[model samples]
Target: MIRPVAVIGAGPFGLSTAAHIKASGIPVRVFGDPMVSWRDHMPAGMLLKSTPAASSIDAPRRGHTLADYCAAAGISRLAGVEDIVPVGTFISYGEWFQRELVPGLERVRVVSVDHRSAGGFEVELESGESFTARAVVVATGLSGLSHLPPELAAAAADGPAPTGPVSHSCQHHDLSRFAGQELIVVGAGQSALETAALAAEAGARVRVVARRRVGFGAPPWRQPRLRPGSPFGRAWSLWALSHYPQPYRYLPARTRHYLVRRVLGPLGAWWLRDRFEGKVRVEEIDRVVGAEALDGAPVLTVRTRAGATGRLVADHVIAATGYRVDIAAMGFLSHGLRTRLAVSRGTPNLGPGYVSSVPGLYFTGLPAAASYGPVMRFVCGTEFASPRLTRHLVAAHG
Candidate 1:
């Protein structure tokens, strides 16, 4: 009997990979609610860092691009590089793609995945149902990977909740809750800057604190045209990283990790500058050394580049600190399975076609960024990842 391939997420990576596998005449089962992360975790007025051209969910067949969705849905299609994509619009497009290509997607949660002694895997769902699959692709995206700095984590007495004195930026879906309150947003990246802007526009007193000077991306017209363009930006380096990800794994482990962290380092969108610049107070400091709740309000102790220390108090603190990929955080993978899989800096050590050390196990999306380059960190990477992994599965398991 042939078992279906299990794709453990409904996000861009999982949906695109499952669509490709199904197109190749392979049976696939996709799990998780469609666009749940974008719809639930992201703030209400957030805009995607990716441009309209780079925001499509890849599909095996044609007629499913973001342009197609916008045309069909009567929304004006945005084609210019300066045209920004709203998170809400992207979420709707993803749901549309799921309905069109991967209609059989299961909206249930996968409680655990364990390897069978005889060779496949046992997948247990939250509904108490179990199934076996010949192969498993862990495309869970950034669900369990929200990272909070140690200083801020200690300040949240009851843990980082959306309504608490200290919380990670990923917790809130609406910034209006903080209206008429004081907010101190930590980090210089798009998430922090945008969250501060949104909160200020919502009538909150907003301030931004960063370890370094805040930077914004260059205007699209100012980008150098001598080099070929990639979804990230127009540069020879960005082109190579986005197009030739297969070679990225062969680089030295230190270099690979370094590039993954530094290539797309902290920066804000050019369009967001007007909304953020004068509206919020931005403070450049050495680091946030400590944080604590004082009088039920969050107080952050910071150091200056000149070796001076000071404190900033706010009604609440939002740690816009980004995500960190750690396979161990994936509680669905049994401890035994996690320990057996080889990893580099908490990410799976992937081989050709996104397969991990375990023959039948695979991972993609943010988890693959370390091995496949920074392109895997965005939705457009599905264009390169989906077909390659699908081909590998067909050849190896067929």
Candidate 2:
């Protein structure tokens, strides 16, 4: 019997996973479009928060990398977002990767998914067509889930009324779209900072809401010992290394999870803090209490940690709030698959191999990131994830 597998999503993770599986010569069907979400969402003039080394999809077999592309074009590689890597450019790279590496990918969306009574899976698409396979892998990026603070919903509903011109910064594209508009940005992460910077350059009067009394770092970092080449190379890469094999499991579960939070969340904030100064106002330890439309502007009642409260008026409001991965949000999930997916804190319970407790079902990307650490979400993890997932799936079917 010919073994078949279905791979969902087409971002870096989905694309890379498909490339690897295809190379293994397994019959694989991939769903979704090139940069479907990334190209359509994300504002214009946005720079990548990650460096070239960390933000690339690993090509299979012969190995053409982002570095190869840059070198071929004589484009110098840098460690930081010194310049914006346009979504269009990345989309182009992804297309080239697909055509040059894994051709014949299915470009339809998985409108719904169903598990066969005899085992395995089937995906029903919007076109009323369904494909069945022995296993399915979900690699959709943050496409299915994003959190818009409940506080902004009412104002957002009011005639698309912006705080001053408020919108979730993710939807922001061309700077020319908001020339001379007053914008209030929320959050201190890369997306928030980049949105504010781009809006400012677009000539918008912008101020960022840094609610933390003291904002966090711009990117997570670590002590010198954790570098990949260091003696305690694992420890040296601490800031960037979200996990460390057997050492992590030996520790108490709470302690292990604590270490993960410290390294991935706060460390990232620390690495990027210095960049926010002057470019945007930082309101540390502040909270958005309530927002109401006053004189056609968003009047946000904010309370600082010091117990002082005030109002901020802006034409628009941007919530750089991060994304979520609850499987329920994925419209494509079938009741059978949903029931089978292991649940831990509303996410799939993933084993060490990145397989869910559901036997043949596998997971990659954010779903596995919690257990696999930050690497699952980064492009760098393809080396570990792709091979592991592909090998396991192939062996089981073979």
Q: What C-alpha lDDT do the candidate models reach, one value each?
A: 0.92, 0.67
TM-score of 1: 0.99
Kindly report which residue stretches of model 1 are placed more than 4 angstroms away from their true locations once superposed.
Answer: none
Residue-level lDDT for 181 in candidate 2: 72
For each predicted model, how many residue pairs clash, with residues at least 3 apart or on different chains? 0, 35
Model 1 clash pairs? none
Per-residue lDDT for 326-376 in model 1, tens only?
A: 988999998888998999989999999999999889999999998999999
lDDT of 2 by residue, 1-398 (tens): 56478888888788888998888888888888877767777776555555555666876675467666556556665334333355556666677777777677778878886778877776787779876788888888888566677776666664332334446655656656666877787776667776777777778787878654434432223434334431112345543453343233345546545554444442223334444557666666467887777666777788887889888887777877666568787767877778777675556767655677776678887776655665665666665677778878878764
